[model samples]
Target chain A: MAKKAVQKAATPARRASDAGRAARIEGGAVVVTGICGRLGRRLARQLHRERPVIGLDRREFVGKPKDIEHHSIDVRRKKARELFRRPDIAALIHLGVMHDPRLGAEEHHTWNVIAFQKLLEYVERYQIPKLVLLSSANVYGPRPDNPQFISEDAPLLGANRFSDIRDLIELDMLAQSFFWRNPGTETVILRPAHILGTVQNAPSNYLRLKVVPTLLGFDPMMQVVHQDDVVRAVRLALRPGVRGIFNIAGPPPVALSRAVKLLGRPTLPIPHAVARAGVERLWRWHMTSFPAPELDFIRYVCMVDDRRAREVLGYGPKFDLGSTLRAVDEERWV
Target chain B: MPARTALARIGDVAADDVLPFMGRLWGGARRSVDELAVRVLGSDFEERARLLQARYAEAGGDPFGLDLETAKYAVMTCAFFHRLWFRAEVRGLENVPQGRVLLIANHSGQIPIDGAMIGTSLFLDLEPPRVIRAMVEKWSQTLPFVSTFFSRVGQVVGVPENARRLLEMGEALLVFPEGTRGISKPFTQRYQLQEFGTGFMRLAIETNTPIVPVAVVGAEEQYVNLGNLKWAARALRMPVFPVIPQVFVPFGQMPLPTKYLIHFGEPLHVQGDADEDDAVMEEKVHLVKQTIQSMINRGLKQRTSLFF
Candidate 1:
């Protein structure tokens, strides 16, 4: 009967948002934000070996670790809302979004949707029982009528033809309207897909270039994942009764010319209107960092369906697609 | 920088000596084109393409890409138009059962060569050799080598969530639902039947599958189309400008060998309620379009000559 009147008005709004706040949601201090990103410093060195991490980032956390607490401010400062006036912080993650394309579209919409809308208003005024966000599978874009896998209820249309992915699809629609106006904060979001390793994204800098190019008669079917499997799908979306929007994807889909012949490089091809007019004249002569509608991610099928993160956040991908395309030639240091 | 590591040691010695001698001369011209496709598809067409490439390499492949060696050279070029240009003659290939069925055909020629002669008679006369899949036109995934040869030959993108994930992976799909309106009708609306699309009877009543029907009969006289220009198919954004006067001659763009036949029928099963009412899925899509219009009127009354 209308799914039992939507489970009788969703069980007293999920038991009045799980009653009193003392369910610690796995004890204190995660915070993380853009903790000097290389995927926010490998998710703050694996969430500081199990909680109490903090970091936030205006950049300098370089070799950071001594019991991690960095905080170089500006997450749109008022001294970054004084570290959410700590109520033992347990989970805010956000992975500080930005994505450069040589910055200024008004500093990429005030650092990606006004600093993730002031960290979702300090994760809804610090009732922070977990939040996550990471947000990507390129906001559902590389289309040509998608559906090869797609599915986290599909439509974001990745900023309809890449208007510089409009603030990461408006910060994944402001973490899906703060996951419907915070039913007491288990937000989640993730999205994943083309992550790949040694993070300088854009499919790990188009599989660390030295020839790559493609699109001539477009190959498509892509997917990717492994930035330590998006830090293990943000540690299973900070666990405690997992929240929504999952998508994470990793190994299965391959053919963008067999992932550039499984990265043994050598590609070139061109002609999608001469590689979108030579990557839009080498991205307006700052000499290329891609963006010619990101060559419709090598021309189409965006790829996703991580079977609801392997049946609800038990997630999967422990790397194999030859170590997730050899983590973009790991440690290719200068 | 020491001349960029001596031009990365001569681009790593021409990627270790000219890409493995041009991948061993492209693997000896792809093993002499799979030995000229097992001497033109016979001697048990390489054990039915190695049992359908070990059933899609034991499922570690075909995540809607298929590539069983590009579907064994697109079933050796549609088994040369199903054995020498539409000499097709298929008939009830054992009413095509075995797992997750559907077929449902009747899309006339005008081009999908009766879906490549019913996917080359279920990959060259059935018995443990299925393949089929079909769907396509989601703007042929925006073209470029017709979307990588329709995803390495299994073909997909006519979404109802890719036909309920190729009928939940027990495969054999095909469909047609008279899309592109029965392959661009006109030759005085050939064997009639056009309006089908109840999205494959709500994907065969939401995946309890079995539908079959098929009935091809010489792809409605191959390419006779005589009409549809629809303002030059809306100024060339295409989906039907067909007016096929044997495509302005020359090789007349091939088609008319005509003699196909096909048929199949039997399987049906079809119970109801896949979110019911569209006048009950158009009366079970008019009982599978009146069983493919009485099997294309009993295969055009057992045809004796259309080019046979």
Candidate 2:
């Protein structure tokens, strides 16, 4: 019944906003934000192979892809679309999500939440046909009661657990709203579970640390997708007519202990009860990289069922569990 | 979670025997003790591994993440108590079928020792030893190290999905429908069965699995539940905090020698919709409850003394 109220409230606001503009089909160039990052640069290049793209970010791609026009500006402020070559870009790919834990709540709200709102305002104005938002599966939050394979429809209980998770859930909620409100903009939210590779990580505690500390009693299973697979999923989302939320998890869920071993690192087994308090102290002392609540991830599972992504979007992950585990950079020990 | 499949595929074989011999330090009475333990507890190492392998094959992975070697250690430890401490006598073993079945039993002892004894009976006493995967009480999941310990030992938290999936995979499931009431109810209501829940009946109907009514004798006197420390348990997020007065006294913590009799009834088949009306489901549940109640009565009547 409460959900009914949310739906009823969202529909009218959307329709009221849509009443002002003349109904028209959306088409033109594709605009990719966060184009300087590793994933963004590759995604822009892939999109550019099919059609022309306008790259949006404050910096240039280190090895910029061919024929992709670049625009330099922060999306937080005024009419940033003026820099675009054309008014109507066919799609908007948001990959500029900031993931550093050092950023406090206000900073996260500004860049992750408020700036995303500002981008949607631009998307609403342009009536962009498609929007592919790459979100993290951490939105599920690690919990003991979580099913072995959680589907996309599982509730978002992660927001209140960790301070950093709040922004991710907020961004997802905002995108979901946009998905329902403006049917014209086909918004596809890709919740990719722990993407492991040599280059990048998905807010992982296992990476960067020489000796990973895990709860002695708890060895939660993990579902990891390869970076290459994530690229393929995001590319599939940008295609002509794909929409809705999908869990972009890959095959053969691996336990946290096994995953650490596969990465060629040793682990320090700590008591599950004391681990939280110890991690909190370590976080406060600036000795540890992750926040206090992230200890929950190491203790409990947050794996998702991604068969929907394959069935609906035709996304096929190339790397199996073994290959993906092997792909992680052993030299990445920080 | 994918334990032996990939590792075995790469030819780094998981030892065929669940127990890896600890070199020469394991000599003397230790070797004789292990053999005596296995003989008395009644589990062949090879047979245990074979059972676990079949279970792993059906489940596609170590879904519960049970370590067979550790489970063997646990079984050996439990068998000492089950065989000597309780002197348990099990009956009607052939009534338990090979495929998926729910053993609806009355829980006692203010804890799960009754459940553990029942599980040991199936594992050690049966011809083709069956690992009875018991579902944990929901509150038990909140206990920090305890929950993980339970999972690693192949006991899952009692959620409907966990039960249904395990049943669909043709696993033998153990459920105490009376739940916390059956186990945690004060010692005054000890053998008196509490009102049974109909969830198990609905699940049995849904999966088309047979239901076996079981009665356990002598567990009721284990740890007397004087009263529940509701406030303390609530603050600690525990299900029920039993105020066992016996816990305070030295050697009082141990239960008095109480012989246990486990009687497994015929696998009664119920035909109906899983989502049928509550009245219909409750009526079926009552039938199973009555069967168990009668079994408990007979076991109590046949018991000659407390410490047999």
Candidate 3:
């Protein structure tokens, strides 16, 4: 599937008085954390068209600084004043944090939640008008019998450390957004399911050993969102009045078995107990020293109800599961 | 409701009421039959005779008085020929009112024999025989043999307009919100409820009719898909492979006669008053679907004997 640009068509300029008010302001700048990541790079590029985007990351992208400004900063280090010295930073997109489950509970708690708390404080200190936070669908846990697609109103069971941290971050974001009670400085928390798309020179969480090796023949019934959809959702979140958590996933849930079949790769169904034991052995051997919490987390299927994304945000994916799987198989990057 | 007339009440009694007194007469009659045929028939002749009598009662055939001759003939021919021997257990039968109510059950199985069995139970066991008008898919209307029988039995064609029309006339209508997708799910996805369309809720709200939740087990295990022919299905405009079960043909694509259990949960009363909120009604409908699915899962867990 061809990736459609997330940039909305330009509308007529504001009236003379409004234009004059806008002109009085200096350069409008947006701060994007983890801009070196797959989704972060797309968001930076899209936002840079209208505003000067500052890409903040601990690592560097291949061809990033050629057009946009890149800043190396760790969000957890309380370098708020140093990072916010750029006078034109009007909005903040918090995408930085450790997503690897190999990181233990304490590390994840400190990086994902504690760092987010500090970042939220820094955003408020800098008085950024808008904030877009990325969340995950892991909060819903597994519900095999729930054919209703696990709506937002469904009970959440965060059985692992990663999801528990995610839940806390979401709670904090919601609390602060409603604290000042200013709808103008809105906050959009997007809970996206497993995202599958091309990432140059980087191993994706989805493409890791646990899921990839598990994909023998038939795809497990899991939901995956394309990278472009994530970028589109971020752009939509930048628009005014798009608040609250939106479950963004592909058009329909794709089975992992079906996805492997689409890739024309054979899949072997390893029993859940056997898979768990294998991961434990890998951890003991220190072949990859990431914490096994995420493996434990993936054991519980993650599926979300995308009704709100369709009904409210006017956001829907261009491709269904079949097409998305084909694109992933072909390694097409947008 | 007033008491039935004395003659009518007496006629409503089962023929088995006089079995003890007439046992010797029937026993002698059976002995006069050919010895070879009797030996081949085995020892369940009495049970078979009782089943025929029940089927006759189901078809509105009375075994007493002047109607006995016609009833006996019907039993000897059609009833015996259509004899369906399968174990069935019904739950929440007490919640079904004797009036015109809307019955909504999950749809599965290629021919939807579950619907026929439920109709049989209602006609035979209910205090007053009730006719269950079910909404069948438009595709079924194009199939040979099925379309005519459905129409003859007063089944409504499953279109939005037809459904509303049936509800307008205050007829008991059965509909499967999952439609064709529910039935076509492979054995791997059996017993899991598919996404239910909101048409039933909309119709219930529009007509202010009560929606009774129903769950049927044993239908899914009847047909297990060994493999799906995707190209063939696409050419035929079908979504799944035609299933081949172990019972029907041993190795061919035919369905097995698995024992069935149909459980009807309590009726969710959609308020008839015009002032009922739409959101509240939708929530109630969702709760009803959830309740029925839970009941189904619970019943399935309790069923230890699937082979019988």
**Winner by TM-score:** 2
Q: Model 3, stretches more than 4 Å misplaced?
A: A1-27, A76-79, A82-87, A144-147, A153-155, A160-184, A199-220, A288-301, A327-334, B1-84, B87-269, B272-308
**What value does the lDDT take at residue A219 in candidate 3?**
24
Candidate 3 residue lDDT tens string, B5-98: 7656665553546665478778876776545334433344335545644644464331111122232332232211123434566667777875
Ranking by DockQ: 1, 2, 3
DockQ of every candidate: 0.26, 0.21, 0.02
Root-mean-square deviation of candidate 3: 22.0
- Residue-level lDDT of model 1, residues B129-184, one tens digit each, is 88898888677777788888888888888878888988888898998887878888
Q: lDDT of all the models against the reference? A: 0.81, 0.77, 0.60
On the 0 to 100 scale, the lDDT of residue A159 in model 3 is 52
Tens-digit lDDT track of model 1 for A232-315: 789777877677788888888888888778778999887799888888888898888877888888888888887867886788
B-chain TM-scores per prediction: 0.32, 0.84, 0.67
Off by over 4 Å in 2: A1-29, A45-47, A50-53, A76-89, A199-205, A239-241, A271-287, A314-316, A330-334, B1-31, B54-60, B125-130, B137-144, B206-208, B224-252, B269-277
lDDT of 2 by residue, A91-168 (tens): 788988887787787898888898889888888876766788999888888877776667788888886678666888
Whose DockQ is higher: candidate 1's or candidate 3's?
1
What global local distance difference test value does model 2 have? Answer: 0.77
Q: After superposition, how far is residue B103 of candidate 1 from its true place, in Å?
A: 7.4
What tens digits encode model 2's per-residue C-alpha lDDT throughout B205-260?
88899999999999998787887888999999877898898878999888766898
The DockQ leader among the candidates is 1
